[model samples]
Target: MIGREDWAATALAEIREMTTENFAAELESLEKRKRKKDIERRIIEGPKQPWRPTRHGPMREVILTVNKDWFSEDAAFFGDDQATRENEFGAHAVAWLKANFGDDVIHARADRDEAAYHIHAVIMPRATVEIAKPKAKVPTATATRRMLQPSIHPLIENYEAAQDSVGEWFGGLGLVRGERTAAAIREAREIGQTPPKRRYHAKTWKWRRQEELRLKADARALKDERLALDARVVKVQEREDEVETVFAVAEGVSSGAFVADGASGQPGLIEAPVAKETPPSSPTLDALRKRSPVGFARASGVFGRAWQRMFGQARVSAEAEAAAGVADAMQQVAEADELIAKASALLPQQTRTIIAKIRQTIPAIMRRLEQRVKPVLDDQKQDGKGPEKPRRE
Candidate 1:
């Protein structure tokens, strides 16, 4: 359906400029009529309703565009002469306008430059109607006078009748109506030929359930990814803290803050540096020791493996002693993991809150994609353009 957006008065000049010889002449001849001056105003005013807030008045003119692709088919298939049948359709359309609207059909032209061959028509708001004259004294004979007035409703109200007449006119050229088209489909079915299935759109319960499951899966996946990133961050923090601890221990040894008793009966400096402070206790660590012994064991094993790798190539030299000095470094990471587990337990709740906010926006996003993005993609697909080539990462 053409609306205000499809057809505008400003486009009239552009249409005129594109006209062929026949159409140009018709439009030129049409401009001389007194009604031509008011065509824009009448068309604009006719489709308005002051009484109804959202309703529009009827259109003052209508344009009918015939499907151009239909003309490309072999006319013999429809039992018509291949050469002249397409021209007949255009003639029949023009004839119908003249027969129906008469002088009120101010201008009509056929345009060929568009994707489809179409007829553009301008109509004045005038209809011929008959009114009975006042009865004679003895009612011997009644007289009537034809009146011309601004009315287009009669044609709209009798639209089916007009369509039937046009279909009958086009029937001579083998054009079929809706009923005939349905009958043909049934006939094909009887002969074991299947018509293409129609596409339908509806939000069914099954689809709704699937969509719900998809959203839940998306939320879960997002939560898992965030948790993995958090774990990486904790690991990096633990590594930094261990480096600092090693530096502090070395500083203590160099400053003589750490000392060992000599094996002999004399005071002597110790070469092996031992930790001066015991590991700090935390509520989270205490909970893990009491309730999750297996988890604590697994964490200890992971730290032990890291310790082995650090001292794997050490010899019985200063290097070997130096390697032993940093063995206690991973203890801090184990305590940090226990603390992180407690923090991570609260993450699912926070993730659910974030997912709920995102869910609220999905409907609007879907609507925008359907309207703006989907049509372009569909058109490109139909044109054999396929999707754009994927870029290399």
Candidate 2:
């Protein structure tokens, strides 16, 4: 999340020439324009085409609209806030489209300036047998009349009615109402009827444009901020690596220097000394003594081998534990990715909220990993020791 100061600074830096009043005006204008453009793009692009069966019939277009009334007081449902009502609404819409329309709904935004803060989505209405035949026979005509038809499903009817209701609610809040659908408004205009006054005035357009620039500047600043944060994270990771090295060294020191009986037995600090001078010979005694030295060497060798086996096992265990931890982290990353993808598929208002939530959680996760890795690294560093040298035969 960006602080207010940072956002203000970036805004001031990007559009220093414009007065605060003018800037605000321009910002609002840009947002409205942007929204309009986005809607147009979705409509033109159409819904993603799905693979159809050879025996299956042609598809039909279904256009759906929602009235502005279903939204919150501040038009917060339409605004670019994280966790806003609009996002939840969009999610619901998409879910409904996919489930009821068999995933063939093409989403389109109508270019109707008469209805500001409105949405126009297109769906392929071939899911049920009832709507399928009409849709298939005259797909375009069916789609065009779907909004005006009285026999339409109650769910869709309610959604359309909610727009005017929402506008009335907004009017109560001292905000202008945006009630008419683009299609309805256009028909009135074509017939020489005086349409309702636009909620957005010239000043509003100016403010919207300014806000767009501010948002763009803020986004650029955010990109730099993210890069810096990533660098810091990398540095912290390097420090953790150093700490792990320390931990390994400390562990080695704690385990002692050498093996005595075998690789698995107690560690030996130093090797036993070899006799330099030969004693006067008693054949039997000499033989036994000779055997003693050989037995001692063999026992020590066995102990060394056992120690190695135990050390190897410890290393493998450590590696496996580390791998498991990495896997867990990866799983979380995948979940975060999924959330991001879902957010992206939504409208701008909803997208921001999901992204914000994801952003909020990242730092905490990073801190937790750093804390866990630090101690092990510290131990490794403190235990620093070199390998032992081989003795002469």
Candidate 3:
């Protein structure tokens, strides 16, 4: 009974009301147009429906945007020359839009609600499509009447030409066309591949809200993963430092660099960090080292090999690090424009620019803050800091 009577009565009623209200404006517009058409025809009433919009309509929308830096909240983009740049860009942008779009641009607005100046426009691409009137029953001397249907204009046929034309018009404004996009398109065309299609972020709450939620979720996940990784890294670092200390003491005792406490009538136990819980740390190693001096040396060697196998090849190579730093510096140098574009005017641009310029030239940015990063392999190598053990593999 409930299913037949009111399964979703509330929802259905709300949907019906919402849909009717949404189309109410369209109905009003159509009625006004119908009255005008009636006056033109000199008739009492117009057809029930004069025009109906099709799925594949002749109407199109275009959005033009200025660089966000131009309209900074705090300070000017070009300092005192900010107004000059804005005026120049605005004049050119308006001229370009009007000239290209003309009277066919039915609905157009310059929106400055955001920091950047942007134009929103709708283009009606109108053309004529002729249809010959059916033959009259009675023959006449005059030719048959013809009716013409509307069609889209040829101006918007080539999208690439429009893109190039806009960039060319704005060439003087320091705002370059999407260089990466153009390069990618050219590369694809040269290789006989289809050029990448341009994409626009949809300005709807439904999609944007979902995207925001997804990004937040991803951030949380990444943060959790980082914390877990940090914990593991801390454990590994502490253990490595302790193991290095043990190796140093063993080497000094064996090489007569320093005498062991046992030789001086002290305790026989070798110094090592004994954890509170029962944990394995080269379990067989301590036992073998207690036997003889030769046994101790062999046991340490065996333990070192075991550690290498367990840890995999995570050795710090200075040459590799240097190469990476050089590559980063070269990349920074090449993207000098990108650095300028990304910097906000709210902050001190001159200071940031100077810093970037300095960094771009340097082969590597020294990470001095991170004192934790040590050259584990280098210290073991010909540094004379520790014993030189023969690598097993």
Candidate 4:
């Protein structure tokens, strides 16, 4: 498909330039003879009605081009053996022309043209036919008119027949007519009709190339979608894992495996402890007020035992004063257990719409890691020590 700009570049690619008989001169000569006879007939008949329209004049131009990728990019004609394709395609086209137009096709010369290996020809059809012109007797007649009838090129005469002719020529080379033409022919076959072609096609390599590029872009878009889906799936799994770890720690605290330390002035993660046996699940305000220090130590967990070891006499009283209110401490643990349970049940989901807010943040995470490590690397360099070699992930 040469554009207007490309036409200049492709001028040399026009292979197998063919020139047929001078259609204008020949058609005029036939028209003149036909006119003389028409005039005589008109005089005798007194000018008949419903005459042929002016547009129904004899053919002067019937331009046709046979352009197919098979002749340009296929193995036999072009791709692997370009010379062979150009030669054979031109030869076939010439042979077809001769068959259809006879030796009037005297100037078919194969040229290595076309990134466009197609051939084109213009025809002017004029068939000599026999028409009766009354004479006194045939023996007495001197010479009769070689009547040239108003005939048409096969293309204009019967487009379908012309389609079959051109299609069959390349059929031997494993090429069919255009897709539309082929589909129409298939329908015609089913209906048991031939010729009077109802379909025609004008497709070019440019159209095909655009289709190819469009498919490639669609493929890339699908690939990107798949990658995004995989990333989301991985992030979901990570969220689930984090939720599971939190659930385990909270369950331990809720079941009394770990409890708030009575000895610590501040009850925190490090001061939390597990019960040695079946101690009170959590320290309650009533239990702390009613139970003695010894009973409280037994009810407490590892923290009670650690307090006993660290402060022999003082720990007995420290337990009651450590937490501001035993009920408040138990309430906090209960709230934590509830929070962990909610987080576990939600998994990748959460109270904060974690699932809805999922985003690809690997680059941000990596940048934060680098920010943390820069100071360490700087310290090492300041101490006259080379930074540690970075680990390859």
Candidate 5:
């Protein structure tokens, strides 16, 4: 997927394309106006004399081509409106040129006629070496007096007449002059010097080391957290297994018979009910005898007569056999209940342990997240240190 930076770059490229197209159309219109004015001036003046074009015409004409690139779209500095943004950017570009090249910056103006808005500028000595040297400083008083002097020569009158004859279109796109100092110009040139390359190598190595450490820390933290969670899961599962085993045993034991009170010769025996509405049958003596042999023997002395009444014709030997089966079933039920109770008592402890483990893992999890994010931040910082690539067409 495309990232945020990639999207921003694409948007900038589109803006540059729009600006270039717009600037080209405006330049064409300016050229046409200049040509039309020249033709009209020649017709009125009649041939033979050397015709000097207006200052605006020569300056505007010299802006033969424009090279555009997207700058920042900082709304705080450029303002909100598109027109305002375009104008602010144009002004900044012009200022930058003037600071770098001094008086060689002859003209600069923004063109608005095309779909894409941009600035057009003219350089006096197009190449760097051809720039003129600064003139010697003169007294402020003398410069002020020269500016106030009135025109006297007929040629001066002719110049003013020519300027007045042209329409607004021929003059509106002229350049504005700006202040430039010798110190500022020197500083701008100094910026072109190359810095030592060794410094950058050392910085890159340091950044790489820090990134490696951050990655290791992140891995360690994640591993710890996963282990903690696994331990908790194991504990919970073990408790559940214990509980289920006890419950299964209890169910098996519940399906049996047992001896009860109220009997003379033989004790009364309770049996598992066959159906919800049906009355239970008396358990055999053999079943009771197997469950509690001593009790059965003791009861036989006093309840032998009652046993005959409750279970008529049931043999003592047969009842004793049944008692054995009931005793086994009762033992299974008792063991099941004991196992269930033991597991149930341990369940809360297991649950609490699991919760504690989760809590213990939280700090480590957060530390891992921080470690994972650190390298990305460091990479960004290193990227910021690298020299910016110039924007191109």
Candidate 6:
């Protein structure tokens, strides 16, 4: 009943009032057209109703509605000013109907005094429209074509197109498409709240609405999980950076290499900030210290293996963290554009771009780290030392 109107009453009252007011010129104009052949039958039988079977019943006027959701109070549909939005929507709707149905669109108007906004349009469904002039006949035609023959133009043929066109029109007014409005209604209902009355009677729309709401919820959950993963990746990167720093310092100290000028303003060995007692080397390794370079290589190889084991574990943990982040991001890719946009907005622009790149590059980073460590492990194996566990520092 929300969009329903008493069209029969309006039509009868308006027509009778015009006749009583002595609209002679209007009567003359109407008479210029063919009169109904069964006027006496119509009068006796009380005008053939829509529910009754009649030869011309299919040509009766169709009542169509065009409007947005009323109940949600969604700003996209209701907007800041209701009257202005309704008027604008009406103008667009009437124009669209005219464009589609041409002169067959008899009347279209908006009614504001209701729980929801909507437009009621009366469309004459007479599809065999008479043209003012006949279009040119093809040269191949042997006989003359009748100029007065009406062209068949079915209104129901373009029903789906018309539905899509209406959606596109409303979208220009900042309203989401019909499905979105339905989803909002469904969501409200799922949470034990009453939603606004539905415009359509079809149950499929309700199901679709619920599905959309679920998808929206899934998208939001995935976004939160992604953000949490991003934070984890950042922490992992920080820890990796710290490990690199420690490894670099250890390399400089062991090799007795020049520290950067930024540190000492000279190229010389830098003493450790706090000198610690060196742990006792393994007897076999200590004995090898006086041996040839090959023996020293074997002893150093043990320490190298220990460092590799430690950092290798760190690398695996970091990779696992990155992989989880990437998985969350990939799931987001399958979500609707609206959900994805909302999720993306939660992160900074640079961070979003970087995360995407990290997703793409993480596997390569892992492979490279593996390649760098593989040579040392291979050298240790080749040195013919039974795999001795390195002492922990």
Name the best candidate (by lDDT): 3
lDDT of 1 at 22: 27
lDDT of 1 by residue, 1-393 (tens): 112443445344333332332233333333434347555554454422211131333234545544566666645455564555446666877787777777556666666645666666655444333222333355423222222233454554554555566677667766654344445566788999986454353333565688789999999999999999999888655543433232222232223332323354232223235443423331232343344454444433443333333332122113333334333333433343444344344445674354344334333322332343335445545776564456799
Instruction: Assess the local accuracy of residue 177 in candidate 1 as a C-alpha lDDT between 0 and 100.
Output: 44
Q: Provide the TM-score for each candidate, comma-separated.
A: 0.27, 0.20, 0.32, 0.30, 0.23, 0.26
What are the Cα lDDT values of the candidates?
A: 0.45, 0.41, 0.46, 0.44, 0.39, 0.43
Off by over 4 Å in 3: 1-56, 73-87, 113-115, 133-155, 180-200, 203-393
Q: Once superposed on the true structure, which residue ranges of model 5 sit more than 4 Å away at CA?
A: 1-204, 256-339, 345-393
**lDDT assessment of candidate 4:** 0.44
Ranking by TM-score: 3, 4, 1, 6, 5, 2
lDDT of 5 by residue, 294-328 (tens): 44443332222232322332222233433443344
Worst 10 residues of 3 by lDDT: 364-373
The residue-by-residue lDDT of candidate 3 on 112-159, one tens digit each, is 654577776656553322222225576433322111112333346665
How well does candidate 6 score on lDDT at residue 49? Answer: 26
List, residue by residue over 1-393, the lDDT tens digit for candidate 2. 112335435433423432333333333443444556755565566432222333322333333334555554435534555555544544544554555444334453433343434444443332221122221343332111111121233334455454444444445334443445555667879999976565553443576788789999999999999999999887655443332222222122223322123333453212223322222331222232243443333323333333333333333335444445545544543454444444344335564464455445444433534444445544544565222244679
Taking all chains together, the TM-score of candidate 6 against the true structure is 0.26
Could you tell me which 10 consecutive residues in candidate 2 have the lowest summed lDDT? 141-150
The candidate that achieves the highest TM-score relative to the unseen native structure: 3
Model 2: residues with Cα > 4 Å off, grouped in runs = 1-205, 256-393
In model 3, what are the clashing residue pairs, if there are any?
none
lDDT winner between 4 and 5, please give it: 4
RMSD over all Cα atoms, model 3: 23.8
By lDDT, the candidates rank as 3, 1, 4, 6, 2, 5
By lDDT, the better pick of 5 and 6 is: 6
Candidate 6's C-alpha runs over 4 A off are: 1-56, 59-83, 127-155, 180-393
User: Residue 83, candidate 4: how far off, in angstroms?
Assistant: 2.3
Alpha carbon RMSD to native, model 6: 26.3
Give the lDDT of residue 166 in candidate 4.
Answer: 77
